[model samples]
Target chain A: MKRIAKLSTLSVLVLIMVFVAACGKSGNNNNNASPSPKASEAAAAPAAESAAASESSQPADKKVVLGFAQVGAESGWRSANTKSIQESAATAGFDLKFSDAQQKQENQIKAIRSYIQQKVDVIAFSPVVESGWDTVLKEAKEAGIPVILTDRAVDSEDTSLYKTFIGSDFVEEGRKAGQWLVDQYKDASGEVNIVELQGTTGSAPANDRKSGFLDVITSNPNLKIIASQTGDFTRAKGKEVMQAFLQANKKIDVLYAHNDDMALGAIQAIEAAGLKPGVDIKIISVDGVHDGIQAASEGKINFIVECNPLLGPQLMTAVNDVLAGKDIPLRIVTEEGTFTSEQALAALPNRQY
Target chain B: MNRMFRHHLFWPLAILAALLLFNLFYSPDFFNIVMRNGHMYGSLIDILNFGAPLVLVAIGMTLVIATKGIDLSVGSIVAIAGALACLTISRGTDQNALSLVLSAVGLTVGLSFFLGAWNGFLVATTGIQPIIATLILMVAGRGIAQLITSGQIITVTSDTYNYIGNGALAALPFSIFIVAAIYLIVSLLTRKTALGLFIESVGCNPQASRLIGIRSRLIIITVYMFCGLCAGIAGLILSSNVASADGNNAGLWYELDAILAVVIGGTSLNGGRFYLTGTVIGALIIQTLTTTIYMIGVPPEITLVVKAFVVLTVCLIQSEVFRKKVVQRWKTRRYPAEREVSRHV
Candidate 1:
C-alpha cells in the first residue's frame, strides 16, 4: 500500500513539474508572438473592408466568419486540397475557421453545433461518408448558416440545406476510367481478368466510383472484375489486398484502383510477382497525384484520371459570392480531365497541386 | 548490474553494434551529423522524429501485453482523439483558452476511456478475447473518425496546437521530449510499484492472481485504458505535426507497427514478462532499419519485404529450437575444457 501511494505521488509530482515546464515555455512563446496576432489582424482589417465594399455596401464591421468542417487527411490529395483551401481563405480575406472531422460524422456534428453557436456566416464540410448528415445539415439550416459541400457530396435530398456544392464528379471520374479501358481492350479475346482496389468502404468516393465504373463495365461483357476488395485508399493496404488478389486469381490482366495510392500499392505487388505492370497488367486509377503522375510518365502506370485538389481559389470565390447574396449555382463542378502517359510526362514538371 | 549485462538484451545490443559497423563501411555519410541552431540535424534526427510515435505506442503496448492483452484499436483511437481535438478548436468562435483546451482534452480522454472501458468490459465481463474486442474497434474506429471529419481533412492554424508536435525544446523536437517524458512517467509508475508484479502474475496465471485478490479484471481494464490514453496523445502529436486531421490515414496501420515493435522487443504476444526499455530499443531498431533502407536508395516498395525478413530473422533467432541448435554447434566448435565450463555455467 505504501509503495503504491509512493508511486502515485511520484507520478503526480512528475506530471505537475512537466506541466509547469510546458506552461513556462508556452508563456514565453505567447509573449513573443502576442503582438504579431494583433498586427496581422489589423493589417487584415483594411483588406477585409475593401472585400466587403466590393461585395456589398453592408457595414464593413459586419464580419462574416466561416467555419469549414473538413474530412481528415485521408490521402496526399486530401492534404493538398486542405492546403489549397487554407491558403485561399487567407488570401481571399474571409475569416475562415477549419475543423478536421478526422472522417467521423459525430465530430462533424459537434463542429456544426459549435459553428452554429459561434453564429458564423457559413458552414461547409466534405462528408466522410454519404449517410447520417441530414440531421446535422438540417440543424445548420435551422441556425441560418448556409452549408457547402466540397470534394465528396452528401446523401441529403433537400437542396435547400446547402448553398452550393463545389467538387469533382467522382462517378464521372470512374466512368471515364472504365470507358478508357473499354476503348483500349475492345478487341481482347479471353476473359479480361481485372482486379479492383477500392477506396474506403461506405465512403462517397468508394461508392460513387464503384457504381460508376461498374455501370460502364456492365455494358461490355469482356472486362470482368474477378476480385474486388477495399484498400481503404492506402498504399500499404492496397499492396496487401492486391497480393491477395494475385494469390486468388491466376490471370489478372487489368488493375483498376479507386485512387493513386492503391494503384501504386498494386504496382508494387505486380512488380514483386516479376510481372510488367504497364504491359502485362494495365493500370488505371484516379487522383493524379505527383507520385502517380511520375509513375504514369515512367510507364509503370498506364492511365490516370485527374481529381483537381486545388479547390481553394474556387471555394473562396464561392464563399465571397455567397456572402454577397448573389445567385449561385446549386453545383459548381471543377473542370478536370484524364491524363495519358504522354500527357502525364509532359505535365509532371508543371503540376503544382 | 552484472547480472543485467548477462540478460538477453546483451545479444541484441551486440547484433545492433555489428549492424552499425557494417553500415559504416557500406554506406556513405552513415555517421555524419550536421549541427544547426545548436541542435543536431541529419537523417538520424528525422528517423527519431518519425519513429517517436511508434515508440510511444510500443511502450504502451508492452504494458498491455504484459497483462496478456492486445490493443488493435490504437490506430483508430489516434484518429478519434485527433479528430476530436481539431474539431473542438476549429469552431471559429470566441474560444476561451481554458475552455478550448479543457474541452479538447476532455473529449479526447473521455472518448478514449469509453473505448478502453468497452474493450475491458468485453474481455473481463463477457469473456471475449482482448484481440477480438479490440479488433471490432480497430475496424470501426477509422469509419467513426471519418464521420467526425465529414470526409475532409480539417486544417487549422492554431500555433498553440501546432507546438505540440512541431515545436522544439532547446534543440530537440517536441515529440522526442514528449515521448521521453511519457517513458519516464510510465517507467516510474510500473517499476516503482507492485503494478508490474501484479501484471506479470495475472499474465502468468489469472486464477492465481484472482486467488490472491489482485482484481485481475480491473488490472486488465486499467492497462487497456492506459493504452487508449497513450494512443490519444499520439494522435494529438501526429495531427498537430501535420496541422491537419485526416481520419482515413492518421495512424493508419499503426497497430501493426506497434505489435511488431513489442514483438521485436522480445515481448511474447502470449504475455508474461514486459520490458519498456526493450520496446524503446525495438522502436529505434525499426526506425534505424527504415532510415538505412532509404539511405541505401532501396525502392520504397521493397520496405515491407525487408521488414518482414527482419522480423522473421529475429523471431527465428529467439525460437527455442534454433537456440538449442546454436548452443549445440557452439559447444562442438569450442575446446573440450571450454565446452565443459560453458555447459556447467
Candidate 2:
C-alpha cells in the first residue's frame, strides 16, 4: 500500500513537471525561455518599472507594449498568421506578450484579462469564435486597452469594442472563387455538374463562403451544384467525402471547395479515380495556402483566391495609430488577389507559408 | 421457429429495411449499380465501402460492451494509428515499397494493441472504472498523434498503400473486403473457442466467474486489446482513403458512433449477450443514414437533427415494453368505442 502511494505521488509530480515544460516550450516561441511562472513575473516586474521610468523620462518615443492573444496553431494558415504577427511585432519594436488560446474562447478571454492587468498599450486577438466576446471586449475598453481583431471578426453589437478589424473579407474571397468558375464555364453547351467540399459546418468561414459562392452562381442557369457536403476543413474527411461524391455521381465537372485543405484532399481522390484534377474536374478553392499554391502551380488546382493571413504589418500600423492618438478606421480590409497557375508558379518561390 | 421471431435481431433488421425503403423516396436510383471499367459504381456501393471502417470498429466495441466495459479511446487510437502509418510511409526511403507499407501497418497495429493493453491494465489491475481508464488515453492520444505527425497533416501517395482504402476488388471497393475479412475472422475465433462462453460468464457476474476459475482480468484485457486492434485497422483504412492523416479530425466522435452501433445492434450496456451480426447491421444503418441525409438534401447543418430522430425511433422500436404499451393503447381506444356503439344498438 505504501509503495502504491509513493508511486502515485511520483507520477503526479512527473505529470506536473511535463505540463510545465510543455508550457515553457510554447511560451518560448520568441527564443526566450520564460522558464517558470515566477520567471515571467520577474521579467514583467522589471518591464513595469522601466515603463514607469520611461513615462517620466521619455514620453514621445516610448515603445508600445502590445499584448496579442492568438488562436492556437490548428492549421498552416493559423501558424503563418501567428508567425507574421510575432515577426512584425519584433520589427515594430513593440513589447509583445503573446498568448496561444488553444482554440478555446475561454482561454482568449482569460489572456485578455491578464493583458488588461498588465496594462499593455494595445491588445490584439484573432477570435476563436464570433460570439460571447462582448463582456471581455468591454472589460478591455474599460481598462483603456484598444482591441484589434486580426484574421477573424467578432459579432459584438457594440462596434466600439474593437478599434478596427484588419483581415481579408471572407465573403469576397468566396465570391472571387465563384466568379472565376462562372467565367470559365459560362459558355458550356450543357449543364455543368458541380460538387462542393465545404469547411467545418456551422463555422463562420463555411457559412459565409457558401452564401457568397451561391450568390454568384445563382444567376448562372448552366451551373448546377449536384452535391454539397461538409468536409469539416480536414484532409481525411475531405478525401472520404469526395470519394463518395465520385461514387454517387457518374459525371462531375467542377469542385468548389471552401478551403485549400479540402481541395488538396479532393485532388488525391481525383487522382485515385484515374482522372486529372485541375484539368478533368476543375477546382477553385479559397485560401492561398502554400500547399494549395504549389498544387495550382502543378496544375492540380485551376484557381485559388487569396485570403492573406499576413495581417501583421497592417495590425501593427493600426496599433501605432491608436497609441499615437490618431483616429483609425473601424474596418480595415487587407488587399488580396486571385491567382492562376502562372501566378502560383511565379509566387511559389517566395511563399512564406 | 416461432420463438426465433422474437429474437433481438428482428428489430434491428426491421429498422434497416425501413431505412432502405425510405432511401428510395429521395434517391430514385438508390439501387442502381454500373460496371465502369470493371469497378462497381453506385450510391449503394458507397454506403458499404464507407461503412466498412465503422463496422470493423463496432465489432470490437460490441465485444467490449458485452464484457460490461466501454472503450472511449477507440477514436484517439484511430488517430494515432493513422498518424504513425502515414508518418512512416511519408518518410520512407523507398516510398512505394510494399514491404515498407506492410511493415508500417504492422507496427501501427502493434502500437495500438499496446495502448489497448495499457487501458486494460488500468481497469483490470488497478481497479479503475472502465470509462475513466479509457478516458486517460482518449484525451492524450490525439496529442500523441499530433506529435507523431509533427503538428501537421502528413500526406502520402503510394499505390500499394492506397489499395487498402481506394482499390477495387471484383467491382467493389477494397474497404468492404477488409471489413468482411475482419468480421469472419473475429466471429470464427470467438465461436470456435471457449472465449465467447468465458466472456459471457464474466460479463454475467465477474465475481462468480472468477470463483469458477474464469480469469476475468485477462478477459477484460483481451477485449480492450481487440478493440484497439480494430481501431488501428480502421485508422489505416481511413488514412489510406484520404492518403493523409489529420490527428484532430481523423476519427473525431467515432467512439460515440461505435457505442451507438453497439447499442442499436441490441447489445446491452449491462453486459452478457453479444451479437456481431447486429453490430454489422447497425453500422450499415448508420452509413445508410448519412447517405440518406445527402440524398434528401437535408442541408449539412440540420443533418444531425434528422439522425437523432431516426435513432430515437429505432430505440423506441427496440423496446418491447414500449411496443406493448402502444398496442394496449390502440386496443383500449378502438375496443371501448366499439363497445359503446354495441350498447347503443
Best by DockQ: 2
Best by TM-score: 2
lDDT of 1 by residue, B197-284 (tens): 8988888888899998999989888888888888888888877665667688888889988988887777888887988887887777
Model 1 chain A: ten consecutive residues of lowest lDDT: A31-40
Q: What digit string (tens of lDDT, one per residue) describes model 1 on residues A239-261?
A: 65675455445588999999987
Candidate 2 lDDT over residue span A56-113, tens digit each? 4436576778899987655667656766676656555678898777567898999999
Give one digit per residue, the lDDT tens place, for model 2 in B156-256. 87888888888899878899988899899888888998899888887899899999999999999999999999999999999888777877678888999
Interface RMSD of 1: 14.5
TM-score of chain B of each: 0.88, 0.97
**Pairs in clash, predicted candidate 2:** none
Cα deviation at A177, candidate 1, in Å, is: 0.6
Error of 2 at A22 (Å): 7.4
Q: Candidate 2 regions off by >4 Å?
A: A1-75, A82-123, A139-146, A244-251, A270-276, A312-326, B1-4, B334-337
Q: Indicate the docking level reached by candidate 2.
A: acceptable
